[model samples]
Target: MDKTTIICRCEEISYEEVEEVIEHGGRTFDDVKRLTRCGMGPCQAKICTGLVANIIHEHTALPLSEIPLQRMRMPLSPIKLEILATNSTAFSAVKSVLDEVEIEDGKVR
Candidate 1:
């Protein structure tokens, strides 16, 4: 596979980036996640976690079972802004929380 080939479309992570993380002491899924944010996107690792594991296995020659999978947190369902906006209760609830938080350049402040 091409180094620049995109592995995680949601986060725009490439195979090369993942390899670099491994080369730099990333031994597990979470390690790669912390170093490169590979699976922390809208899809939440649903797509790329397997691919990442495969890469790790290929590079380290580790058994597939030995590579730890990324943990899935709560809020499995994606709450869309448009859907929330259409519902007053949901919108208000989200808006109230958002009011207290500051988001700049896609990062929460």
Candidate 2:
């Protein structure tokens, strides 16, 4: 295996590491991402989402659709609470936009 297979280029994960996670019963995209950090990069899985899905599917019996993609709507990655607190303007804008929306029994409409 190449020392640098570039699984998650933003996070510097390797392909071998992701495969190892799949080999160890990682049947879902989230499972693999959590265990191997493949889809949790700066590109926010846009760069490696399909690839990671294929890798996990190749090692498991589950179908591709069964594994839901990670949340990609907004605020993509984990940000510190403090950081979020500091970005009041951006947070307020996002909050206002989100607040204007309504959810009817879990369905956005």
Candidate 3:
């Protein structure tokens, strides 16, 4: 793939950036995400997961099954803070995420 080819469109990440991350010992999608913010866009990894997986496979010889999937969260669309503040039952999916958080020192991890 061309280095300038857009991989994660939402974040405007390019193939070169992704390849650089892999070359620097980034082995997983999350690793690339932390380094380049590849899959954390508005569409999340939904659009770039397979493309990134392919890149990893080509570079590292890792099998598709062996590649770890991106950690997806609930609530695909943006929600207002007021909705969360309301504590209403509508955003239960978001609530589930809050419930699953690992907190330490009164901070979310």
Candidate 4:
């Protein structure tokens, strides 16, 4: 694989960068992330973790189960600001947002 090829598009991390990290003893996905910021993005490792794990495996000969997953913080998935900025215990917040827009003639109005 080309070293210039991007492995983690979220953080703009490249194959060479990840490979370097592994060469220097980065054995886990988290280790590569800490050193290269590979998975810290809007996707939150959802897209890159598996790919990074493969790199780690190739370099260290470690099994997939032996390679630990990266640490995740709150907002595991993307959340709209509206969901958190407003209270909706008494109503269907998500449904209300969808209810506001009406579709007609293949157009949103």
Instruction: Show the lowest summed lDDT stretch of 10 residues, model 1.
Output: 89-98
lDDT per residue, candidate 4, 3-97, as tens digits?
A: 99899998899999999999998898888888988888888889899999998888889999999877765557878878855665755544444
Residue pairs of candidate 2 with colliding backbone atoms: none
TM per candidate: 0.71, 0.60, 0.78, 0.71
The segments of candidate 4 whose C-alpha lies over 4 angstroms from its true place after superposition are: 80-82, 88-109
Top-TM-score structure, candidate number: 3
Which candidate should be chosen as best, given lDDT against the real structure? 3
Clashes of each: 0, 0, 0, 0
**Global local distance difference test of model 3:** 0.87
**In order, what lDDT does every prediction score?**
0.84, 0.73, 0.87, 0.84
lDDT of 3 by residue, 49-71 (tens): 99999999999999999999887
Candidate ranking under TM-score, highest first, comes to 3, 4, 1, 2
Candidate 1 shows a clash count of 0
Reference-based lDDT, residue 92, model 1: 52
Candidate 2 stretches with Cα past 4 Å from truth are 1-4, 76-109
Tens digit per residue, CA lDDT, model 2, 1-109: 4636776788888778888877787776677778767666667787887877776776675688887776565566667778877848666666444775899999987
Clashing pairs in model 1, backbone N/Cα/C closer than 3 A:
none
Give per-model CA RMSD. 7.0, 6.1, 3.5, 14.1
